[model samples]
Target chain A: MTSEIRQFLFESLTVMKYSTADMDDDTVLGPAGADLESLALAELSLRVEDHFGVRFEEDEAEMFAAMTVGEFCAEVARRVQTASAT
Target chain B: MSRGVAVTGIGLVSPVGTVVEEVFDAVCAGRSALVRPPEGHALHGVVDVAAIGPAIDPESVIPPKDARVVDRSIVMAVRAAEDALADAAIEVGRDVDPYRVAIVLSGVGGLETLARQAVERSTRGRLGISPFMLPGVLPNMAAARVAIKFGVRGYTSSSGTACAAGGQSIGEAVRILRSGEADVVVCGCTEAPLFPTFADAFGNALALARGWADPTAASRPFDRRRNGFVLGEGAGVLVLERAEFARARGATVHAQVLGWGATSDGYHPTTPRPDGSSAAESMRLALRDAGLSTADIGYLNAHGTGTKAGDAAETMAIRGVYGDDMPPVSSTKGVTGHMLGASGVVEASIAIMALRKGVLPPTHNLDDPDPACDLDHVRGEPRTTDVAAVMSNSFGFGGHNVSVILGRAGG
Candidate 1:
């Protein structure tokens, strides 16, 4: 599930036109790394939420740029499990 | 502050094509870009015919995520702005002070973006809308995006002067440079108004050319068979620099904007003043400002949009200014269609090219000239002339009239 979430994030970043050839689990999702801005982050988060049937809280959306790829993927994995259980 | 201004660089994305030389060649050869939008085109069924530029991928300039959010108007503006800057070899903060540069882009920007976003909100709900929608849809966003792309942090603004916006931008740039506010200005207009809703407005108003089996012949400016102007989309940008500064910097001067005149008809919202008194006044003012007599201007780029009222009024204005023996005149709109605000600068560029090449681009589709628009029309074939100066005119729906005079490069 974590790998699946990571792959989804990679595909989403590619679609968003972020240079992800050197992107990795440790890569920051935004300015310091993939360079996604607030708007792009919001778009990526929404796409993830819709695809996984999970959601990012308002604060999480704001911190999207600060989170690493691994951290974001793990968070989405947890949310997907929670959504399924609920 | 009446400082001399020179057009050092020109960037155009018109129906004729993007490259400056190529667009000039197409115009001189009378190649029409007006046609029925191809099947599966966004405007295929929205309107009958328009002078449409080639398909552009906004992502080619902007990042995909951001490109998808912003309007096509921004994309075209940035492209033209880039080309204009490269052509002039002017870099903000390097060649000239960043604070001493300005951008005066003009047009009804983001119309297609606004229309598309409104539909998305209706179908996808409010929450599904991107937060970037508003920023991307504002009329000034095209100018803003270009400024952001180039780090132009000077007196940046846009003109909403309808079809005259493009001409007004150049005029405004001259004003800014003359005032010593900026040494260089990236001035022009961009438009992406080829959408269904906008098409409906013009179509229902009986303002669009119709019943033309061959779309290429639809935009017949000054022709007796002309019905109305065909709409077009594109951007035209000019890198205007203070003449002294441009010469000092060893810039490649294309043509010097000797003078410009701006006026208002104050007549009607949609109709031109039949007498074209104010429009003629603008021409007289431009000639006077340029320190030239009517005979000095060897070529005239007219504001003839192929519409009966517009062509006739412009003819009156031209005759009122130059009398019976007017300079060789042509309206490129016969080929380019009416690009609204962008037409002003694009036509100005064409006039400058004509001056440089000693060849005037002919008015396409002028098979039968209207008696009311009787003038020295450069019809059927390009006219070669050794002209040192030229006048380009642009008149908009809001009674806005602008006539600009350009002299030979370095002269």
Candidate 2:
């Protein structure tokens, strides 16, 4: 599931014309080549809400900065599953 | 050396048309490019297709690999620059020294791609982030891309001074050329803020016309019923050369960029000062820079976004600067909506066209003018007049105000 989410993110970035060749789990997202700016991030978040069926608070921007790609996918998968359980 | 910068070439991407001829024809014929949106996507008050132009074909301008790294704004900028170079009959590597060419582009928003990427990273993960995002999202990327395309090694910079970005960019280019930093400069602004986030943000601020059902009526600048401005996206670029250099090269000079003035309100983050002092000062300084008086200007291209505050403030500023001898004023926004950073350049092109053709385009959709905006707004049909000099105004968010003065060559 984590890999699946990572794939989804990667595909979306490709659609936005961002190069993904150098992106890795340890790559810095902020001030990096293809990292979305604050404005772009907000837009991407809304798209994710529709695609993943998960709602995220504004504070998630910080958490997003700290997590790796795999960790981010796990967190999203966990949230989606928890929401289904509810 | 004491004269104004020469306008040798112009490139525009507006709703009316992409090329200069198409836009000029549309304006001259009093044609409104606004249309009704097909089917369910209805915007209130604004026209459905206000001056929509052709899409930027990247293949025609840049290679596929390099084009992939650019956003909409950069694509528009490069295309316009290419067109301008062609229009000027300038062969980049042969006709002119690449080192003496400068590029100064302006924009309001950088890249919508970044906004989309952020959402993906937050929802999916950091591993999803692309490596090309930062370079793609920077404001200066448009200028950098243009330089790379043309092999221009001189000064390259970008300004994000909101709506005034276009005028300010052109003004800065003029200064650079005058100061001998570069013999020729390509200056303009591009904007592509059609993303949902931009719409929502402006909608939340009540800056956009709420009536999505009628995009045609959505943007009514200077109309008594006008509410707010309709969001727009496009680019306008101009080639500026030192007077002596242009004359020496036997270039066809369209008009002279006599002077430019830029100022900040220092009062509001998103609104103009009520008294219009800063806006007035900007125009005053521009006229002073040109060594001309109010009586010398024959036309005015107003930054009339149709917003209540914006129109009133601009009107007051014009009255303060020109006193009783106000020139014919028109807001092309009624036709092009508001291209944000590109508005100044687009309007400047219109002014130049007016000078070349000896006619002034009308302010469309201005049926019943607000009493506050009482200037002689060229309305209904294009007016025939021998325009010697024209003043174009552009004020943006953050209290940025810029004015440029262009005169007929040999004046």
Candidate 3:
């Protein structure tokens, strides 16, 4: 799941003229990876939700502020698990 | 209590040409870009000839998916902005503080997107409308897109004053610099007004030139045979900076923005004051703001849109301001066609070029001047003269009038 999220992020970064050679799960997602702005972050969030079939509530959307790609993927996976159990 | 602003760079994406030198030469040579609509076009029979510029390839400028949402006005604005910054030798985040840079763009909003989406909503219902519909058609999107692309975090704004928006944007930019708000500003206007609905509206208003066999000869400003204005499309952007800032950075200054004046006719919605008093006041205000007299001005770029009312009114305004000693005047709209909101900045750029090159561009197709527009009109060929100062005028549909003065570089 972490690898899949990392791949998705790397692909999205390509549209912003960023190369994937340096981007990774352990690398910081924004302000460190590609210095993404609010627009780019929102776009990334939309893409993530579309691909994973999981919804992020207004409160949980702050998970996008997660420092690294791994942290963001973990948050998404946790949300999906909780949703399935419910 | 004000500081002077200098124009360091100019970008043009117009029907005549894009490169500054090429456009300057074309305007001087009296080249016309107006042409009849291609067969099968929606407005082929409804509208007259249009001065359409070269195609703008969105795939090359923006990502495919991103380009799909925004209007072409935003695309053209971004292209012009990039060209302007490159010409100014500015690396926004590297040369100047990103936060101290500003953008003031002008346009008539995104009519194309609005027209298209309205149809989709009517035929296919609410779900057919894209989520990006609102963002695509907003009037401020051009400025916003340029700000986002260039990382110009400071003061981003747009103007929608009918046709005078471009000139007003530049004038507002001068105010911003004078107020010590920003060190640099990317200012101008862009328009994607060639869409069918817009063409139909202008045609329906009887504001477009018609009945000419040769489209190039259709826009004859200041000529007795002139019918009406020709609808043209293009964008022009200029990089403006404080005189001291440009000099300190060893940048090549193109011209100094001496003064700007804006006023309202307050009479009619589309027609200018026939007496031209209010327009004259705008010119006088600009001269007063520059602290210069009539004798100081070298050339006048009239907002002669090849229409009977507009041309005569602008001529009256010129006579009102200059009296018997009218400075040499010409209207490049005969060649470039009226670029609507973008005309002021484009003509201002051409005025700066005239100042730099020492040649007055002629009013193309002005073979027989109208008796009402009797002035020292530069016609037939380019006039060789020393232009120390030039005043460019723009009047929009909603009675908005603007006059901007630019002096030769270095004072």
lDDT of each residue in B101-179, candidate 3, tens digit only: 9899989878889999889889966434655677689988888888877778999999889889889999999999999
| lDDT tens per residue, model 1, B1-411 | 446898998998898999888888988888889989989878898788998887788888776667867787788888888889999998887899888899999888787777877887798764566667777878788778888788888999999999989998998998899889999999999988888898888888788999899999899989999999899999999999998899889999999998899999999998999999999999998888889999999999998898889999999999999985589999999889998999998899999889899999999999999999999999888998899999999999879999999999867
iRMSD per prediction, in order: 2.2, 8.8, 5.2
The global Cα lDDT (0 to 1) of model 3 is: 0.86
- List chain B TM-scores, each candidate: 0.97, 0.95, 0.98
Give every collision pair in model 1: none
C-alpha lDDT of residue B385 in model 2: 92
Let me know the TM-score candidate 1 reaches against the reference structure. 0.92
Question: Is model 3 an incorrect, acceptable, medium or high docking prediction?
Answer: incorrect
Note the Cα lDDT for every prediction shown: 0.88, 0.81, 0.86
TM-score of each: 0.92, 0.81, 0.84
Ranking by TM-score: 1, 3, 2
DockQ (C-alpha based) per candidate is 0.38, 0.07, 0.09
- Best prediction by TM-score: 1
After superposition, candidate 1 runs with Cα above 4 Å error: A1-8, A20-26, A48-60, A70-86, B63-65
Most lDDT-accurate candidate: 1
lDDT of 1 at A57: 78
lDDT of 2 by residue, A1-86 (tens): 67777788777667655577888756544455346655445545555666788888877754566556666677778988888889
- Give per-residue CA lDDT, model 2, range B1-411, as digits (tens): 645589998988887787776787776675656555334432333333333445677756766545665677878888888888888887667877998999999895455877878887898685456545766788888888888888888888998898999999999998999898888999999998766676667767878755545566666778888888877888999999998888889999999999989999999899888778999999999999999999999999999998889899999999999998899998888777788989899889989988888889888778899998878889888889998999999999999999999999777
